[model samples]
Target: GAGVSQTPSNKVTEKGKYVELRCDPISGHTALYWYRQSLGQGPEFLIYFQGTGAADDSGLPNDRFFAVRPEGSVSTLKIQRTERGDSAVYLCASSKDPSGANVLTFGAGSRLTVL
Candidate 1:
């Protein structure tokens, strides 16, 4: 698809384990973002990347969660010492503009289950 592509659609891990999720944006989309959605809650912003750098990463919960888009196209979200509370649907999105208005396209998401 031309939209964002997220790998490992689903993941199950034990507590304290580490995980890495991948996202591939549509060609030429310069703005990429990562969000985590818990059961019954809205998606929470995790990070925002513009081009090759992260423009807004304040949404990241802590140092244990990090994201990178070294080439402005593909992004990776890394989580360390996973906890049961960390379980959620990790979503990836991309847009043509950096202002983060509308026009955002999202992936199906990588569902993480930390047991």
Candidate 2:
């Protein structure tokens, strides 16, 4: 794909249920990032993967949230024990610059609704 792609554009899950959001970054992009956006708020960085390793995951709010970029192109964000507070839009982005300074191309995001 020419741009970043995310799956399950909208998801509604009951509280305490689990959810997974998928992201397919643009071809050849090595830097992938996951962010969360609450209503009326800017995206908050959740994690960043440089290639297949997690370069940073400081923004993950708790142990219930985890993400992986195994092949360096696709990534998945897993949420366990989902809570109402977890309802938000999950955004995925990819940057092509090796220096990691290039502008990021972001996916439309997966909106999660926890009831």
Candidate 3:
């Protein structure tokens, strides 16, 4: 039972820099997801991985955002050319199934600030 966890808790960076956020999912979870939440808004799906392959990546805003779950466990969200608009909380969640309806357990998230 270790639940999902994110690293750095907070990250501050300048525009045009690169940043990486890490996530550790619960043991035995086969489905992992990444989401972004801006102030006063609900979390928006970014990407999801079922096992070691990305099942859905439609929510990734642009080429600047990418993620990977190579071992079907831990994942990392990488942002290239960070911009002020990218400032938000990067949340990671995991579930037993890849179905969208599955209830996901979430991490506190890594808050990113681009100045």
Clashes of 1: 0
Order of candidates by lDDT, top first?
Answer: 2, 3, 1
User: For model 3, how does the per-residue alpha-carbon lDDT over 1-115 read when each residue is reduced to its tens digit?
Assistant: 5788899899999999999999999998899999999999999999989999998999999999999988888999999999999999999999987675689999999999999
What are the per-residue Cα lDDT tens digits for candidate 2 across 1-115? 8999999999999999999999999999999999999999999999999999999999999999999988888999999999999999999999998667969999999999999
Model 2 ranges off by over 4 Å: none
Count clashing residue pairs in model 2: 0
lDDT pick, better of 1 and 3: 3
Error of 1 at 107 (Å): 0.3
- TM-score of candidate 2 against the unseen true structure: 0.98
Give one digit per residue, the lDDT tens place, for model 1 in 1-115.
4778999999999999999999999898888989999999999998888899988999999899988888778999999999999999999999988777758899999999999
lDDT of 3 at 47: 95
Distance (Å) between predicted and true CA of 109, model 1? 0.1
Top candidate on lDDT is: 2
How many clashing pairs per prediction, in order?
A: 0, 0, 0
Candidate 3 least-lDDT 10 residues: 94-103
Instruction: Tell me each candidate's TM-score.
Output: 0.95, 0.98, 0.96
